[model samples]
Target chain A: MTSADETQQRPAGDPAGPALDRFYTVIPAGGVGTRLWPLSRASAPKFLHDLTGSGTTLIRSTYERLAPLTGEKVMVVTGDPHRDAVCAQLPELDEADLVLEPSPKDSAAAIGLAAAILHRRDPEIIMGSFAADQVIAPVEAFQSAAREAVVTAATGRIVTIGISPTHPSTGFGYIRRGQALGVEGAPSAHQVVEFVEKPGEETAREYLDTGDYLWNAGMFVAPVGLLLQHLAAAQPELHAGVVEIAEAWGTERQQEVMERVWPDLPKTAIDYAVAEPAADAGDVAVIPGHFTWDDVGDFAAIARLNPAKEQDAMTVLGEKARVYSDQSSGVVVSDTRRVVALIGVEDIVVVDTEDALLVTTTDHAQSVKQAVEALREKGDSDVL
Target chain B: MTSADETQQRPAGDPAGPALDRFYTVIPAGGVGTRLWPLSRASAPKFLHDLTGSGTTLIRSTYERLAPLTGEKVMVVTGDPHRDAVCAQLPELDEADLVLEPSPKDSAAAIGLAAAILHRRDPEIIMGSFAADQVIAPVEAFQSAAREAVVTAATGRIVTIGISPTHPSTGFGYIRRGQALGVEGAPSAHQVVEFVEKPGEETAREYLDTGDYLWNAGMFVAPVGLLLQHLAAAQPELHAGVVEIAEAWGTERQQEVMERVWPDLPKTAIDYAVAEPAADAGDVAVIPGHFTWDDVGDFAAIARLNPAKEQDAMTVLGEKARVYSDQSSGVVVSDTRRVVALIGVEDIVVVDTEDALLVTTTDHAQSVKQAVEALREKGDSDVL
Candidate 1:
């Protein structure tokens, strides 16, 4: 087989790092995924779906991909609603690893909760955090890169893995890489010059052309001490609250402290509350990773990762469709129960769920959040 | 309600026709609707749909619109399979008026069948034949025009109602008027100069700019003898065969003759076989009618007939949707069964059916036939 074809056919968990004795991979799997309405409802978010490839649910794929680096050391953080689905999908995770938040909280609190529990077990342990719904390929390459990033983080800098930009995509925040720190065989690490959120298409194109911007893939390799220190500097109250909770970890009082502290924690993205501040403070570093990656942000991106046909590449099966294209464009994803036929259409994303179907050109996929916002304004929580 | 609205309201039978006469509106309803597919299926053809106002089906509406002209004098010619649906929609028509053809021979054969049937009842009977799926306003105006055309037909000319063109439309054929016939207190009657097939957009625009051309609304007023005579002069074999079938009317031999003769018919349209030839012979008359009329040829035309809102003029429902230009300009029909949200979309026909949904720009609706042909090629007879 050709190298490209072989790369496509790599079995899950094969050709990667040895199972580590002390490494833990914590998946921050708790997100409402409201941006991807209908398909990614609160009941079934991105991770539960086999969105990336055939027979590979996003969480299942994530666990299998990470297994080579941290076998039996996987933990998932979710909330009360998706807790069952998460555990049911990953039954191998023990009860202690299934940390459930009593309410819907932001990623900062969830990560802080995971950190508190893991620190109680081993204060100096290195924890590599990954999101549940991401497409990272070339397993061997990813494992090697993760190992290098973790080692760099062990030396005290908070390490973030930045994916090479394949397109000028405004959907993702970008990491501007600074001067490199030498790491043999692995791509060099750099100081994160700045964090730019969802730039305009023209700006994204410029970033792609410049060859300096990396997509913030949201994967972090850090020692608990460094993450807590960064959090303390950025959000002193959250840092103190998490520290007090960690000191009282495994107790009912710890749960009380968490419930009291989390609501008070500003409902801000990690990019704003921690990553950006750390980078500004000159303590944040980004390691360039060549592993094929996708954030699967919207239906269009998901459609791209699992190319359907020629013009019609579908991430999911649609009934009796012949997808032909002039270029790698157009996607038709519908439940196998119904047939969706597309013809002479281009650059459009069609996602069909049981209740609601979305048909938008890829250029407007990011504005699908607008569709959700419209739905919420009309009080359509059933679809939201 | 206004008289125009009342005329438009009746979807079952025409309002001004003969009182409770066993109306059998002969619906020549068997076009491939290649210009309007996915929504317009072979089994459910365009004529069988309620393409205009709510509740009034095209066939039913046609029956009502023509009722003022031929009260209880309606007969339909359709392929055998669609006979059940035709009857289900208009229960007033007797089974005898529902002449079923073995195959889709063409419009000429279909109309010939109706002519033969009418000849058997009364050779002198004035037949006002119109297509079953037209949206015509001002019932009183149409009734007055029909009465005039019937009188004109009695005066020995094959009378065709010509609509004054509102726009340069490449989608329809054009009729040019010759010398004006001084008709009293009525829309002017004229000698038909010539019949032109669909012209180029530029030519259509020129024709629209000139007031002499009228849209060939396809409403023909004729006595059975006059049509038969025209047919005899133009297509002698068909005329002779139809005469034989009429002479052996309501007999088993008549049915046998029809079965044999229809299959042997040249698969020509009426315009090609009779109307165009009659005009060449200088024996056709044209009457300009003032009533509003639409053929509802495709989704775009259907959208045009819908009520306009804010000049954006697309028919829109769904509180969650922020429709910018959902006037009748681009008909978007979706069931309240599901929330259909459209954003930044315009001039498109988005139809959500129970089994299949079609989303195509109004201009592209003409290509919907390709979608249907694909379904038919795949033996999706149920959908087709």
Candidate 2:
């Protein structure tokens, strides 16, 4: 990660600076993240935690990362329960810039609402939709890509910052890249051929070999009007609902209209409602994001994001974690002052929180959701 | 275990009951149990915990198991640190009956001092030394074996209640059984044999098949005078230190004398200082015990002692533990109100305490001692 001064000293693409003036980074903060359970919870989700063991929370880092590029031009779309927490963690965020959802309706509604509201604020505002819980590094590279993405977005095309595949991971969806768009400031911009679902290991490995596939990290930068235009064409009912709420936003009728129509918005992800269809219609472009990134998908992903200090040792995490490991190789996440001892276990993950503890190996980290689901069924929702 | 009423109604051996009148059970509550750490601390130790989820601690159960036979003739020998805990747990125990060692000198000094004291209490009293951190079942069978051991001890032969081998376990020493001794009323008594160190897997299997070996539980039954005589010959310096302390016991100089000599007493296990030597001298006899027993040596041993409800599942232990597991088989011990969720790990062990946590697997449970040792080296003794 580069310092703020360093990033300011080297504005990614100096000439692309004017393009960011009309750009607003829309942070869609949501997801209980059951797969990262015990660490990620209903009341306090993934974005609220410092999953990387860095001093700052994921959402705060997200805000910090984009602040340099977009200045104070940012809006956060999150669930109602997390409003106060989001406000507290990112104090610079104004209450009015926070778009609190009545309930989750997935990516389509969450990001669409943010785009709709930003579009209302400024019709031609170029908006970048970045989830609050992703881990990214090499700030300069990310900012460089964002500049290109903003430039591409201004070309009346919905642009996504697609990450290059580092492994044959089946955990994320893939985006097939096409010929470069030859946009002046956004030289890396390519036509997005299509977006594919998460594939099997064999196919994922094959996708890696092609050098044409990038991980669809659900990040998008586009003119708010273009995003809303696509949503209006593909999900008209959902588009009308978000448009109504956006029109009433900041007015005395904001709460009244949001309570009336927000709950009934189409529950879908942006990938299905807009990105995919837009790609087919040759309206979507991709900017290959060269920066390292992780969604903190699960403990397995966490293992990769934070490598162990030793060659064959567990990755110990926490602000006050007292860990002692011997002849072991795995991951230990402690949220308390408790001393965690890991001995002779490979790829194991131990997550210790205030109210709950989660133990599993990296191989079986995905199964953690099963335990959470079982807890919910057993009325152990308090821990869940 | 048989109920007190049942055990009382059916005396193990009616004639042997009278012999228990002069029989005193010495409870050696020592060993920090580094292998069972987090659950067992320097201040708490393994003896202080109820590893079996039986609602009673190992020490308390040891006392209760022998109470029906020895009445109030029970003495606990432990380190000075555990004085309050041992006293609080066994309120029925007399103050004088609790022998607090100023420092650890291993089993030789501990059990030797107990025998020396009991000898002064009653020269003719037969003493049985039992550790306070082992799990045992079928009180009737255990009592029956104790009865036979007592009967044999009355004959001036230092006797051992050896547990019949249940598996080819390499975790415990093997007592190679000699030919049977034609002692009436003590049918299982065998002639003097040899005490062998823990054997290799193949050797253990061979010993098991031969039906000539029993797990040396380190449980000894002998007349106090005879026990002292053997200790006097084998560990003369240690024997003298204990004798002088026993002489000063109940007098004003007791504390002064113990503080002066106890620390320097020879630190050797009773198995090496007495049992093996006694067996070589043809002065030791074995009483084959048919009851289940475990030293609770490590989390792996804990896995065996407390099997999971499901065949392929983890063993969850703790009175107030809130654990949810899925597709994982191992051991989980939670001492706090924290809910523990286990998923997709085989033979894993997760121990959560107030200030410490331990994650491993049954296969590498013994390696926990290495972790504890590392913590000690790091000077993190507070958690230890």
Candidate 3:
């Protein structure tokens, strides 16, 4: 494996910090992001887009955010179709660190494969798995929380960075924190009681009032060998399949083994395959994340993250000069390189792409998935 | 002058009947139709578009509607820029009958030029001036009403077609019909008391309840000599300029005379220059037209005219198969040859053209003119 010093040619605005020893960042770069249709098509998913108008793509931002901590120890696991796109967007990623899945088998298989590969290379390595399409603010805070999670994971426990709830949002699952672990160098680390599914409005409010639940942002950190052992006990078939593929990862049999085993791996999220079972066994710990984080699940969430300056001003995600709005408030995702004019439309969302255009309201942002489904039913595979 | 029989090679679907002898139809085609922007621009105005999706352009439909009444004696007066497009769309128009204006000098100048030329050729000929961008249905009713108006005009009266009001619409001016003229060939012909401007909502409702007011659709019919006489009395300078141009119309000095006098002609609508003053003089007569007529002013009017089958369905003006709507109700003018997807928007008006896009609502349809004004201010003449 290449040393961290060799990959430390950092960009100007990147966070300057010392690289953590034995720390590897694993990014699960998938999900079609259907709620952001026309802008987030299956051919070019959300991870590949600069959705926040931040000049860099979401995956690129993810890589930049973690590069100071992981350096050359970063790996990305994505499906075959997006392998080239992922590689193109992230040129610094080593060929050996980019894992191309033969087929999608949900989070458990994708993340588990990365953990098994890193464990095989360095048994004592601590790996943190983060989604490539999420947004986190205040790099210092995120780095601090990640450091605590890594420290907690070194004690042979599966660690997750639980985001502190800013509001009673029902869009994300909740993690209920129990007693504090009182471990050295990790003050906020606590034993996780359970992982709960997304709740109703009233239940979400109740959870917020109790102050025990934190938004489960799916950020997991643990020793690579410990995660593989948990996966081996909970999902033995999926674990064995990924381990077999990981064993031939850098060899001539890598492609052959991936094709034979990946297709048969269990199609399940890591939460269902390992996290919940590990919490039941009292092996799960959580470090409360003080930094702001958002999954950017829909345009409404995106609007919330990047709000308009005025109350009724439109939030544009592309060239601001290309959009003209009058008496309208909402988000506009413009990539068509054409002028988009909105008049007297309140809370409207306009997304302009090359082949298709979407006109909806921020309230109907989630229903954009149905539009993608309708397109699929109509055999619009070119756009899909 | 070409006789009616010499110009009777009408198309199949045209109103089939004997052409009215000594009658001429003068269509004034102008107006940028800025209210329907992106779809209607200066280069390609509303009259040139098949807005109704009825396979024929608005001007061609106007020509087809009046073919039975005017035959080959039809004349279209339009701006010089649109002369070639008009001739291309209307193949049957005689070269001598297509009057090209030097520039847009409003309806009075356009119609006066046609009348002066027709009067010079045949003094006793009856002429009817109609707009090229209006939609009138039930051709037989329109023809019958037009024939009566022509008979009324032969009596040397400035005859106009007053459309019977279907609703209390404040978007159109009203003509108060007084005592009947009781002419031999015209039964529904009445003396015009006055021509009122577009009224307020309450005034419009009162006008509809009175049963004495009819919508002034700007359809005027009169003898060519009588119309020239009215113009000479009401707008002497405009009438003199058009007459000078008409005198040199068939001569080699036609372009020179037009350039010398046309720009100096009064830039006024026919209502102000002729109809209003003529009504005040008690020289105007109206023939009540029972045919349905629509100016197709804005997207709201278009939505009302072409309502979707379902209550919450989207009304598409282009390929309906290319539009996908879910929980939305509105009008979509998709001329870009791309798929338009609407999700959870109500009363939305989306106009997609090749160069620009407009997203507004039915309530803000009139404000689209503001968008055009803004684009013009930005010097986006390519779209304007």
What are the per-residue Cα lDDT tens digits for candidate 2 across B1-384? Answer: 234543564456577755666788899999989899989988889999989889899999998888766777789999999999999989878888999998888899999999999898889999999899988899879888988899889888999998999899998898888889877779989975899999999999999999999998989899998888889989999899999999999899999999998888888988888888888999999999999998898899888888888887678888888877777788888899988888777888899898898888888888888888889899888899
lDDT of 2 by residue, A137-163 (tens): 998899889989998888899999999
Best by lDDT: 2
**DockQ, every prediction:** 0.19, 0.72, 0.75
Q: For residues A4-70, could you state the per-residue lDDT of candidate 1 as single tens digits?
A: 4334444555322221334688998866565555668778887887665457678888887777566
Model 2 per-residue lDDT at A341: 84
Candidate 2 positional error at A246, Å: 3.2
Off by over 4 Å in 2: A1-17, A163-182, A188-215, A272-283, B1-14, B164-182, B190-215, B233-240, B269-283
lDDT of 1 at A225: 67
Off by over 4 Å in 3: A1-19, A200-206, B1-19, B167-169, B199-210, B280-282
Looking at model 1, what is the TM-score of chain A? 0.81
Best by TM-score: 3
TM-score rank, highest first? 3, 2, 1
How high is the TM-score of chain A in each model?
Answer: 0.81, 0.93, 0.93
Each candidate: chain B TM-score = 0.83, 0.94, 0.92
- Model 1 docking grade: incorrect
